[model samples]
Target: MTELNISTTAGVFDATAAGPAEGRPVLLLHGFPQTRLAWDRQITALAAHGYRVVAPDQRGYSPGARPERPDDYRISLLVDDVLAITEELGWTTFDLVGHDWGGAVAWWTADAHPGRIRTLTVVSTPHPGALADALRTDEDQRARSHYMLDWRETPKTENDMLADGADSLRALYAGKVPQASADAYIRQLSQPGALTAALNWYRSGRPRHAIGTIDVPTLYIWSTDDAAFGPAAAQGTEQWVNAPYRFEALRGISHWIPEEAPETLNRLLIEHLQTHEEH
Candidate 1:
């Protein structure tokens, strides 16, 4: 993969591109505490299959892409960053695949500008409306999401996450991310202001018009053992996509779907991309 410093309306963004540059472009957005390298496995395979994969480090994670204010990291702004990057790449329409927080951004993008997205595949995140509803009415979801409040609403949350040499982060990736990948993330967040900027995603309230129906060929993939989301939220995602939708549930997989089950995730994504090939 080659690194790219892309200029967008928000600011300069750090991105990684792989596969044949001449092939159909597929924008891959990664979630929190992760860099574009998270898609390493999928990148090579997709590229071999005749697709160009572009993965951005995203708002807070990319040193050059970090915004100054917490409000700047809001979901709307994050969505705009994706749009700006795609436009900067001269892509009028392309396939989009996002994981975790990246999935959240992709959901918003597909809903707000359906024509710009030929197909969408989201992993390990529910549609915004489904997440919101679950957060409001489901006690289990609320309980599980306590970390969001701690990171977003509480004052010392950022400090706490970095305390004791980022022990919390270490624990979160203990069994998931490879040691090399985990080390890279730890080093990146160790930089001044990076972790705080990342945490800001939770600090802001949901984007004003976050909840909307996505009108494009869509695929939602969920792992049964993901700690952050439950069956209710995952199943409810159907109501928000007004187009052809496919939902796949993987048993025994964790939230780190791409890393934990790369082959499986790749197969699902390839199938979705091929089935919804642009005209």
Candidate 2:
């Protein structure tokens, strides 16, 4: 795999690129508090399968792309970064994959620009609308998502996340994230203004409404043990996609699906990508 600084009108994003240049283009987005390295395992696998993949550090995570204002971290702007990065890469239509917060942005992007997305693969995050529905009806999801509210309300979210050699932050990876990977993530976010910039994603309040139906072929994977999203959200996601859709639930896997379950994740991702031809 190769690391690159991709420059767009909005900003320069640090990303990891793999596979052949002439191969099918696939853009991957990482979630909060993690960098493109979160997709390292999948990146190598996808590249070996001849899919050109780019996983950007994303808006807040990329030093050059980090913006201070919470409003700047809105989903719309994050979607903008996805499109801009693809445009810079000269991709007319590409497969899209995202995890966690990245999955949220992926849903919005596919909904807003289905023509540009050939296929969509998301891990752990359901459609915004489906999740909204679940949040309203499912107490389990609400209880699981309490941290989002707590992060936004607490004045020292950053201090707490970064204190004591970032023990609090380090603890987030107890769900089997490789110690080396977690250490790198902590070091990246521990940079000046980086943790706050990443936290701004939580600070940017949810959209008052849900995202529209996504028309592209979509594959949604959720681990049963995920603390953030419950069965209500995962099962509700099928109704949000108007095209060929598939959902897989991994038993006992945590919120960190990609890292905890790379073999399964990679197999599912490869199958999903192979089943759909690029538009």
Top TM-score prediction, candidate number: 2
What TM-score should be assigned to candidate 2? 0.97
Which residue pairs come into collision in candidate 1?
A: none
- Candidate 1 lDDT over 73-160, as tens digits, reads 8887888888899999989989999999999999999988888999999999999899888888898888877877777754476677
Q: Which stretches of candidate 1 lie over 4 Å from their true place?
A: 153-155
Local distance difference test, each candidate: 0.87, 0.91
Worst 10 residues of 2 by lDDT: 202-211
Per-residue lDDT tens digits of candidate 2, residues 1-279?
888999998799999999999999999999977888899999999999999999999998999998889888888888899999999999999999999999999999999899999999999999989888988999998998899988885448888988899998888877489988998999999899998888889988777556899899999999998878899999999999989999999999998988999999999999998888744
lDDT of 1: 0.87
